[model samples]
Target: MKIALNGRPLTDQTKAAIQALLGELARRGAEVQINDAYGQTLQEWGVMHPFTSLYTSRADLFDADFVFSIGGDGTLLETVTHVGERRLPIVGVNTGRLGFLATIKPEEIAQTLDWLENGNYSLDERVLLHVENDRDVFEGTNFGLNDFVVTKTDRSSMIVVHTWLDGEFLNSYWADGLVISTPTGSTGYCLSVGGPVVLPRTNNFIIAPISPHNLNVRPIVVNDSSRIEVRVESRSKNCLISLDSRSKVVDDSIRFTVRKEKFGAQLVKVKGDTFLETLRSKLNWGLDIRN
Candidate 1:
């Protein structure tokens, strides 16, 4: 099988796990294509491998059986941009704090790979928000697996975001920022700001204000079919716009519209590893904390 690999710098513990995984894949005669930056990092850390090729960009990627994202959720997000519309089933190995997306364990890499080869996994397709703006930033890849965010720049006062749902006036948000979160991302920024934790397949978008001036403003859940648009009025004449981990600073003149992307991200889930189980473990749910 062919495998494409991408990752971030390794931790002291995960380094050894990566070495073992590479050796196992080589022994199994699997073809490996690694990201150039990650390959450099591995070489620096003395993790040798029999690599078929190095992928510097999305153009270097071909049809592979799987894409291994070996780091935190940010690395997985970067891998998504690399895979782009090809939408390879991604397996994320967490080596960062609070890994909301990258759930696979490093030690279980060998077993999980075997499971994948034997068709013992399922694919979870997730929604991504697409951004349209007057400025040609983001280089044509304008979708994110998480949420679309607009926040005031550092030291800037709170901004006013005039929002509309499918051309109808929604609300004028007088807040530090606004978040348009997908159900798959309900556990991310939305949850941090008192938004509801929604199931991944709900196909709904949550509009949550960040530190609103009016305390009565609450998060609103809207159907994914609706198009959401926002116009910013900032004292600094600038605001920060983010699609997942990627962000840019732009002026208020840029018209912004966010909608569900045409294609979705594909996450690989091994049998027995369910989302409910992940929540129970990751969030420490159902654990007794009483002393």
Candidate 2:
């Protein structure tokens, strides 16, 4: 089995964990192809690895079988972008807090790798949001596995986002920002802004406002197939638009539209692990205070 590894900067904190991962993969005879950035980090740290090759550009991932995302959820999100429309199955190794998305633990590395080798896993196909703008915002990598956000830049006053669903006019939101999150991302920014926890496989998009001026305005769930359009009217000359972790400041005059990408992300989940299990564990649902 061939695995492509990509992650954030390496630190002394995560060194042992990574070493164990490399040693185990080498022991199991699984081919490891690491990203250039991560490869450089490993070399700089004098961490011995068994990586067969280094891949830099996303196009270079053609020969990879599985994309292993190391670090945190942020790294996994970036890996999703790099995977693009190839639909490669991704396994995330969490080395950060919260870990709402990166579910793998360091302690379970050996067991998890064994399961991966023996084909004891399922794929969780996650919907991706594709952003369209006048001048190709985010350029080639304009899709995200999570939510799309339009927020005010810095301390700029609240922005008014005129929203439309399937070409029909929706309400104009007067708030700090707006978040159109996928069901997979319902627990992220959407949850922080009072959105409901939606099932990951649900074919819907949750439109949630960030601190809306009108208390009555509530987050709404829309069909994933529906087209979403927004025109921003902010006091500041420029506002921020983001696809998951990637954010850029653009002129408020830019009109934006969001839609489901043609191809989705495939997250590899080992058997016995379910989304409900993760959700309940992460959210601490049904836990008694006295327990």
TM-score of each model, in listed order: 0.97, 0.97
Off by over 4 Å in 2: 289-291
Candidate 1 similarity to native, TM-score = 0.97
For candidate 1, the C-alpha RMSD (Å) to the true structure equals 1.5
User: What number of backbone clashes does candidate 1 have, counting pairs of residues 3 or more apart or in separate chains?
Assistant: 0
Clashing pairs in 1: none
Tell me the deviation in Å of residue 22 in model 2. 0.6
Which residue ranges in model 1 land beyond 4 Å of their true spot?
289-291
